[model samples]
Target chain A: MTVVIGFEGSANKIGIGIIRDGEVLSNPRRTYITPPGEGFQPSDTARHHRSVILTVLKEALEQAGLKSSDIDCVAYTKGPGMGAPLVTVALVARTVAQLWGKPLVGVNHCIGHIEMGRLITKANNPTVLYVSGGNTQVIAYSERRYRIFGETIDIAVGNCLDRFARVIKISNDPSPGYNIEQMAKKGSQYVELPYTVKGMDVSFSGILSYIEEAANKMLGSRQCTAEDLCFSLQETVFAMLVEITERAMAHCSSQEVLIVGGVGCNLRLQEMMGVMCKERGAKLFATDERFCIDNGAMIAQAGWEMFRSGQVTELEDSWITQRYRTDEVEVTWRD
Target chain B: MTVLKRLGRRRLPIANKMAVPENDDQASKLEFSLDVPFPSARQAAVALGSLSPDREPRRGGVHKRLTLTGSVLNVKWRADEARVLRVSVNSFLDHLSLVLETMHAFSADVCEDPHVVLGHQPPSAT
Candidate 1:
């Protein structure tokens, strides 16, 4: 039984998980809520990560009933996060590996979500629709590569949700996406918002501006409630995503669809995707919050696969990269 | 008190400007021109040292007007410390403005021990 510890400090959450032989022993997660009145700031995020990451890691280890020495390998989300936050987690993971003399595996966050979906749903092959605060893409496995068939050209899907929440003055408690979903459910009418899609690439910046303008106007006139606008926004945006996912599935000739990322936790979006998948005879799989949102368990799972293949990062090779393209990682799978 | 060593002068193009006001709607906007090369942080500190009063630094925001035209580096002083700096850029003007504003807010409380050089090369002779 190989014990691998995984560290996830990407974005707003800090997750630590312990895995043994492809099975998760403990999935412990901690999320830092940004202080009211302030959005996501790099300095604040880094400070939060420093304070809570160690506690969460300890919790996972204690729950797994394992010591640091019991862990044979360690893994961490390497990049695609705020520079300061990424540095904090990377340093911690590197220090742990050095102290224990264990090999370090730097996992790609996007691929972690994809692998977690596969593990949870037991899907052999599926078209992946990845949507989150920092990423939006329609991916399919082909030629040993997860090709990006469609994606947002500008701001990510979850980012748009968060920004819209801010515009409508929604309490970002629990999670912004959850709050938005709640508001959307309360809303009844569909407000005509900007619908801009260019080929396989989409732009949300313009739509965000439009919603802000409309919401401000409504606030000025006291015409529509915040929930109505939230509902309209979700309908418009999720429809776009569903449409693209369907197109990508048809294009790839894949009958299975997997939705993974922070936004995958949104039940309404999941329902929409489920409907689309059902009509097309393609199955839609979404991971639970344990793996859907940023969590360490998925990282450990992916790291175990990489570790068995002799893929590890050396101390000299340790450097925090802010922008790591998803396609850059060479997927090494063991039969 | 140990006299701080002075580094030579270096100039960098002030590429963009960002404004952060106490209120959401109100903002102070400044422009940057390509013709003028702004003094590096080291040179700026040296120049400020020479120009400012020798008395112990007071606890307040410093409002100093720049001598250059078409562009000026807008520095906001709060509680006797330089809180924010904005540089203007031509490309992606709005995004750059937001980025600079964020950078300013991030560095507000960071300025300390002005005598310590913060990795800026000195300004060269024009």
Candidate 2:
């Protein structure tokens, strides 16, 4: 039984997971929310990583009833993230690897999500829709590569949500997306917003601006409730995404749809995708929080696969690449 | 993939640790300072073009100037106290490359007598 410890310090969430063979022994997560007026501060994220990484790692080990020495290898997110956050996680992983004398593997955060979705859903050829704070893409596996069928031309979907949340003074409690989802549940009227889809790419900036304007007008009139606006926004955006995903699935001729990334946990978006998939007689796979959002287990899972294929990064070979593309890396085990 | 290799090369340290002598002719000849923050690139060009009233090497050449027509941020570098290095793009690609190169060279002290290449636009005939 090979025990692998994974460290995830991407986005605002810090997650640690312990896996043995193909089973997840323990997966615990902690979210670092910026105080009410302050947005994502790099220094604050770094400090949080330094403080919580150890606790989460220890918790994972303790819950799994395994000693530090019991771990066979270690995995951590290498890049496609904020530099300070990635550096902090790298430092912790490097320290742990040095102390434990275990092989350290650096995993791509995006691919980790895709692989984890595969692990949970057992989908062989699923068209993936990965939407998160930093990324938005429709992916399909082909020729041993995950090709991007569609993606955001400008800002990410989750970034748009977070920015809108801030604009409306919504407390980013639990999570910004979750709060928006809750507010959307109570919303009634659907205010028309710009739905801009160019070719396979989508643009959210215009829609964001339009919503702010509409919200301001509503505020001036003192008529529509904020919940209704939130609901309308989610409906419009999710419908746009579902429309694109449906197009991609038709183009790819695939019967399975897997939604991964932080925004995948949004029930409304999942429901929209679910309806589309059902209409097309296609299967939709959504990961739970442990694997849905950023976490270490997925990194370890991908690392183990990479390790078996003899893909390893040298110590000097490691560096944080903020714009690392998901389709750039070669995956050997995909058919 | 070739683009990635070119990007990697551009990211490498430009020079090793060797400070530009204070009195060096070239060092004294060039003027370096941070560019002004503009609400957008088009607005900045309009501002700068109005202020200078002379043909200057538009930032990042015609392509970038065209690309950053409405960009929110841009970096302007002046070399040889004459040419303006307009490093602006719709995306962060060129800006990131320039910043990384500058930091690496500055740290290594090898960026003293740097040669600035103006992209796509020729120097204005004064």
True contacts kept of each: 0.00, 0.00
lDDT of each: 0.70, 0.70
Q: Model 1's DockQ?
A: 0.02
Q: Pick out the ten consecutive residues of candidate 2 chain A with the lowest summed lDDT.
A: A92-101
**Candidate 2 chain B: worst-modelled 10 consecutive residues by lDDT:** B117-126
Tell me, by TM-score, which candidate is best: 2
Evaluate residue B61 in candidate 2 and report its C-alpha lDDT on the 0 to 100 scale. Answer: 28
Runs off by more than 4 Å, candidate 1: B1-126
Deviation in angstroms for A221 in model 2? Answer: 1.7
The residue pairs that clash in candidate 2, if any, are A187-A228, B17-B108, B59-B86, B60-B86
What does candidate 1's lDDT look like per residue over B7-122, in tens digits?
11233443443333453333342322222232244333322222221111233232333233322234322222224222112211222232222222222222443543232333
User: For candidate 1, what is the DockQ-based docking class?
Assistant: incorrect
TM-score of chain B in each prediction: 0.22, 0.25
Query: Candidate 1 on A1-335: residue-level lDDT in tens?
Result: 78889888878888889999878889898777864434788767767876676668778888998877689898888878886677667666765564355888888888888887888888878989999999999988876667788999999989998888887667778788888898788887777898877787778998999989998898689788788888888888888999888888889898998899999988888999999988988888887777899899988988887888789976556555678777777777722
Relative to the unseen true structure, what is the C-alpha lDDT of residue A219 in candidate 1, on a scale of 0 to 100? 67
